[model samples]
Target: MVRYFDAELETMPWTDVLAWQAERTATFVRGLVDRSPFHTEKLAGVGVPTGVVRDLAFLEDLPFTTKAEVRESQSTRDPALPLGRHQAVPRGAIHQVLSSSGTTGQPVLYGLTATDVEMWADVIATAFWTAGVRPDDIAGHLVGLPGVAGGLPYADGFRRIGAGLAWIGGWPTERVVELMISLGVDAVLATSSFGTYLTDRCEDLVGIPAKDIGVRKMLGGGEPGLGQPEIRQKIVEGWGLDVLSEIMGLGDVLACLWAECEDGGGMHFCGQRAVAVELVDPATGEPRAWEEGVRGEAVYTTFAREATPALRYRSRDHVLVTATSCACGRTSPRIRCVGRTDDMLIYKGMNVFPSSLRDVVLQGFADDVQPSIRVWKDGSDQVRFDGPIPMDVEASDDLAPDRYREVAAAIAADVRARLQVRVAVTVVAPGSMPRTAYKTPLVHVRETDDDQ
Candidate 1:
């Protein structure tokens, strides 16, 4: 059965939704001008009108918000404005301050007001409900430390919805499995790689197959694995779970903003009332219509925020938007993240994402290759490469050492045939590559020949 946390907002008419967004956006812009000195200075000559922004086209006139800009704002150490001018609320009113995961570059700090906290909880709760998590289910959250931005919101949202949460962030795979058995956990929250890692270790740790565990639904995010058909199928078949849903969000904008419903469609925009989304051509910076198969970078603007509100915040996450109504009866748009713009590699006039390459390898090799993989370039800071990119694949335990060369050759040939990228695949023994509790790094570059 399909359940909605906020049925009125989730089921609101499409036209009404746009109207609400326009009204809220206008108010939010006005508040930014009044409360945020950084936005006030940045938007000086943009000349945005005062009233309701009835059309999204007006947004193009305003300057785009980038991660660099936010980082710069946070770096300013003026005593009067220690939290940066982008902060909208007073320091006393700030309820919580969080930092980005710093996976790409320097981590930016964000503060949330009391009201912003509630809104964040609501957005996460709606995402959880859409992912088929109910109040009666015990959710085991596998995320980073509680202080990180990615995991804390899930804990708060689960508590808000009256679901029992087992905080197992630092637990080993064996302990996690043991807890699932003892606590009767039916729902789990984890990144795709962590889920795969736990599944791979289940039998060795607990003396039972992963499928024997009682987890019914798996909520995967923090990376691109769950959305890929090959990776998702591996988790579904490996864990013996009935449903798998993907949840996506940004720390700078909102957490758990989009989530997949039970029908397994792409993640729906669950933060319709609180956030407005736009798509723009990554190369040309031109706005694109939110239509099926139209791909671009995601830009977000928050309407009802106090501590740190952003306008036209560039997410750098390339996605294809779908306007088709989902089977779950949500009128909001859905998105499938294609790749991060920073992670794109251009080789011989073709663009490739490492995640896509990993998916192709998984689909072709199945159980022969372990989920752990690393794509490497010969030189450091090299964005573009020509032929025969280097990759290291961890061979499964059951694969014989004599067959390593054959398996590596097959994987390289499959990648060439399917993804049109040439790669030199090296099959290493199991546990050669490092495993991560958070998002896995798909690309690794050796700084110098000596290091290699």
Candidate 2:
């Protein structure tokens, strides 16, 4: 049998992990101010000296940074940071740059020092071991986009494990189906939402269940569908694969991975290399202290990273960090994401989570209740729910509009009554809204009469 796991990283002792992170965190913290200009300004603002953080506790005293700050810095600074005091390594050895494009904000560049690159490869190698990828298995990456540069790590990981690859980036639906059919693909890395879309569409293009296409496992990412049990079941039912690994991280897939171990539990983190995560409250912004059942943000500090390394970067993700020991005999930290910091729609005082809305919609409807929601910038919201109902008043069209109205009203009432917020109800025909290859966004914004 293939090793299927990196014994060195996965089985490292927990005591040693603490020591390792302490040393690296100290070094990284000391360098943070000079490395990025944002941190330098931040240090100046707070009247705190750089290169002063000696350990983990010192991090808490530092002011928290946000995505908005990063964006502002990227706008005015030297477009490309020159090789100077900020440079992590000598100029001659830098091989590749894996930076965020600020699709959401101003793009900040994070370079990978040569050492950072090697560690990244090993981490990725650890990630792919989930698929039981060996020298013999064939792997493919379908959604290797322009930024985030996921293809390289995958290729490097595959090479490290002696696995063969098809080198096919994420393709159009039709092309994806043909390549899988042609190459006899063994493992695939694609977004979870796209996987389901491909499975459903593949049947129409070719009469084959996506599961029967020789893929043993899938590495899913790029959205919130990774940990959703409903979507997970759908992907399995549609594709027929046994293993669906959920990896949650930024564009730099190497930064982190929540790969499922042989056990059926949620994803597990590798503690051997480095990870200093502080799960903070979604509302109050305080560390949850690994509370058993509370949600918080993920502030990550990866000590193993050298090039463009981060110290306590806020991932804008919410989850309950568990200290419960895993049955897999690995003492590494484990995280189960409950929702996203950005995904939550805050209107009128109450926080409405998209995952909560999705769960309610999915469980409450069996028919084509094309569930769609509309939110307004003015802080008002509406929901359009379309599902078949019982025959209460079949004889008159009064019942038609009223029944539809009642259904929408009932959902609105249920949400208001339960979630404690009011929402306008608009009923529509089945198959009204559009679905995308990836997770659907809440695209509609309701406008009031004054604006219209």
Candidate 3:
């Protein structure tokens, strides 16, 4: 049987959903103009009328909010001004302040009121429930420490859903494995990279195979692996998990805003009423229709928020949209992230995502290759690369040196044929690349040529 945390909201018709979103968005914008000085100035500067926004078309008139703008908002330090003029509520009303992971650059700050926190939990819990996690299950939360955006919100979500939660932050892989065994954890919440890493090291750390550990579900996010078919299969086979659901969100916007259903289709938009999602052509910045198989960059706007409300925020995440109704009965549009614009590499007029390259390699050479990969470049500042880009592929530990070389050559040839990009693959021993408790950096550019 299909289960949903909030069936009435999740299964609402498209017309009613849009009506709810429109009403909530207008109210939020009016409150922003009245309470948030930063937004007040921005809206006035843009010549937006000081009234309820009846038409959603008026949102297009407002300037798109960028990460750079949010970062700049933190420059002022006056006590009355607070961290940023983005806060619509007084400081005392804010229940918590969270920071972005800062993987790409400087971390931005986000404040949440009591209501905002409750909404966040509700959305996250709904996502978890859709992904097949239940209240009776014991889940091991494996993510970064509390200060960053990834871990704490999931913990809160699990608690809100009345699940038995184990706080396993900062625990080593061996310790995590041990806890799973001892506690018989039914589900694990972790980044895709960490989940793959744990699966790779599971047999060595513990006496049994990773699949034997008996984790029924792996809830993965914070990166692209779970959405990719080959990578998802690897996790499913390696960990012996029944389902692998990819929950996606941006730290600047919200966590776990979209989640895959048990049917293994694309991730459903869990932020339907609270967040407005749009797609735009990355190259031309023109709005794209949300038709089936359409590809574009994702932009978000908060329909109702008190602290740090965003207006048409550009997410920079390129995605393929599917308007087909999901078998799970959620009417929200589904999306599969193609790649992030920031991480894209343009080569000879073709854009290549590093995750796509990794996925192709994994699909072709699952047995010979390890999940660890690094796309090495000579300079730190370079975004585009010519033919024959350097990459390090980790070979399985059991493979002999001669076999490793052959597998590496074959991988390079396969990637060239499939992705149409030249790659110089160097097969390294197991554990050659660094592993993290959080998201893994697929591309590593050297600071100096001498280092290469």
Among these predicted structures, which one has the highest lDDT?
Answer: 1
Winning model by TM-score: 1
Give each model a TM-score. 0.92, 0.80, 0.91
Superposed Cα deviation of residue 248, candidate 2 (Å): 0.9
Candidate 2 colliding pairs = 113-307, 135-162, 142-170, 143-170, 211-239, 369-386
Task: Looking at model 3, report the run of 10 residues with the lowest lDDT sum.
Answer: 47-56
Model 3 segments beyond 4 Å from truth? 45-55, 396-420, 429-437, 447-452
- Superposed by TM-score, candidate 3 places the C-alpha of residue 328 at a distance from the truth, in angstroms, of 0.9
Clashes of 3: 0
lDDT of 3 by residue, 1-452 (tens): 44888888799976577666776776666666778777777778565545544446556666788888888887777575465877778788878788887866888888877888788888889889988788888998887478566677788889988899987768777788788878889898888887777666677777787888879898888888776676787789988888889888875777778888988768888887578877788877778877789999888888766677888899989888866578889888788888897788777777898988888888887788786579986676667777787889988777788887799889989988898888889998878778775778899977765665
lDDT of each: 0.83, 0.59, 0.80
- TM-score of structure candidate 1: 0.92
lDDT of 2 by residue, 170-265 (tens): 566767767876898877877776776766566666777787777777777666665556567777777777677876656332544666666645
10 residues in a row with least lDDT, candidate 1: 48-57
Ranking by TM-score: 1, 3, 2
Candidate number that wins on lDDT, 1 or 2: 1
